[model samples]
Target: MLAADAVRVVAFAGLAAMIVAGRASLPLIIVVAVVETAAGTLFGTTEHAVLRGIVPAEQLPDAVARNEARGYGVSLVGPPLGGLLFGIAHTLPFVANVFSYLGSMIGVALIRRPMRPAREATPEKYGAALAEGVRFVAGEPFLRAVLFIAAPLNFAINGVIFTIVVSLQRHGTAPAVIGLTETVIGVGGLIGAFAAPMMQRRWRPATLTRLICLVATALLLLSAVLMTGVAAAVPIAVTLFLAPACNAALFGRLAATTPDRLQGRVLSVIFLAAGSASAAAPLLAGLLTTVWSGTATMLIFAAAVAVSAVVATVSHGLRQPAPELTTTRQAP
Candidate 1:
């Protein structure tokens, strides 16, 4: 992960230099994007593993909640800041991102504790190790249920969001209004992050998960019915407001249940599933919007999420409490 961070810093710096020198090419940009994405995946997986190692079980919920809040808080600033910097100079935002990566590298370097799990007596091959993680998650009912609902839910929600953006663009919505809409969503996320720890204490993970799904469905339905950019923004903001609590509960349960050594693999699998859906969302949105009106496309997306919510509510596996696991740091 440290190496990945270093690579990311260098990649961003190189991109910035290329842009500044007026020497950026399509192939160079594509190569840098691929490297940056791979590095980010490595960094994120390692970060999750390290968090599990360093934080004690009892405090993990709060720790993770705070981390979520910090990330959302950054989102509140980063987009607008990036826009401002870009306005000043095309390369400035990339330069700023490089500095951010450097800061992350420095922070990682300062961590005093061991990050890796203790070595096994006879380590499994890479493929076998990954397969072991997949089997473990698949065999677990709660985790399986999460994966089932999460993929389609993500697909629909992201598709709807893309449709909304494109619809707004077609309608010639002012750039400031669009920016404000995103800022509202960011503020909502910040509020959710602040409330997540308390919500976790008040509700079980299963109950919280159900509520999240239901609320998202309602919001999407409302957005679809309204069929206005401002109306859509309202629902999106409310959904974002509730999102952090749901994510915190889900991740806290995941961290509590999975063994330290398998944390990275398990998280990687979950993220990959959700990411695959998100990656296809824009294409799906475009196809749907072309076939029907944007409002109709949104309604279809809302229906899809509603189906996921219904499944989540009725699923025996999702309703059951997640299995408890020891939170003690595994010996290294």
Candidate 2:
């Protein structure tokens, strides 16, 4: 992960230099974008795995909530800072990102504890190791339900968000207004992160997950009907306000239920499933908006969320308390 961060720092520096020199080519830009994305993914996965390893099971929820809050805090600051830097110079933001990556790398390097899990008794083939993670998640009903509901929920939320941004742009809304909407949503997320530990203490993970899904469904439906930027933003803010608590409970449960050795692969699979859905959402939203209108696109997104809510409501897997990890099977 530190190596990935170093690579990102170099890539950002290169991009900044190219922008300053007016020599940025399409291919170069594409390459840098791809590299940065890969590096960021590696960094994120490693960060989560390390957190799981370093924090005790009893404290995992609060630890994860704090991490979530810090990310929301960054979201609150990063956009305005980026815009300000961009106004000063087009390359300035990239230059700042280079330093950001370097700082992250330094922090990672400063960690003193061992990150790798204790070595297993028997070595496992790479494909078999990957397959084990798949089997583990598939065998767990609660995790399976989470995997199922999260994918569509992610897709719906991303589609609606992209649709709103594009619709606002098409309707000649000021960029500052659109940015303000995002800032409002970020504030809500920050509040959610701070409240997550308390919520976890008050409710079971399954219960919290169900409530969040139901509320999100209603909010999305409201956004679909209202269609105005403020109306859409209000629901988005409320939904984000509940999101961190949901995530802390869900992820903390997963961390407790999976063996340390499988943490990286299991988390990777969970994220990949949801990310795959999100990756296609912007294009899907754009197509729907082009064919109909933003209102129609939002309704479609709401329908998707509604389906997820129904599934969560009915799934026996999600209704029960998550099972604890019983044994660490050696790789065979």
How do the residues 1-332 of candidate 1 rate in per-residue lDDT, one tens digit apiece?
77998898899899999998999999998998999989988887777766778787766777778888898898888887998999999999989989988888788888777766668999999899889879988988877877877787888877877887777777899978877766776787789889988988998777877887888888887887766675677787787777777777777778888888888888878888877887798998998887887888888887777777887788787777666645666454
Q: Local distance difference test, per candidate? A: 0.81, 0.84
Give the poorly placed runs of model 2, Cα more than 4 Å off: 120-125, 322-332
* Model 1 per-residue lDDT at 14: 94
Which candidate's lDDT is highest? 2
In candidate 2, what are the lDDT values of residues 1-332, reduced to their tens digit? 88999999999899999998899899998999999999888778777776765666677778889999999999899988998999999999999999998888788888776665677889788889788989989998878988988998889887888888888888888988988877777788899999999999998877887888899888887887767665677797788888888888888888877778888888788888999999999999999998999998988888888877888888888777666634332322
Q: Of the candidates shown, which would achieve the greatest TM-score relative to the real structure?
A: 1
- TM-scores for the candidates: 0.93, 0.93
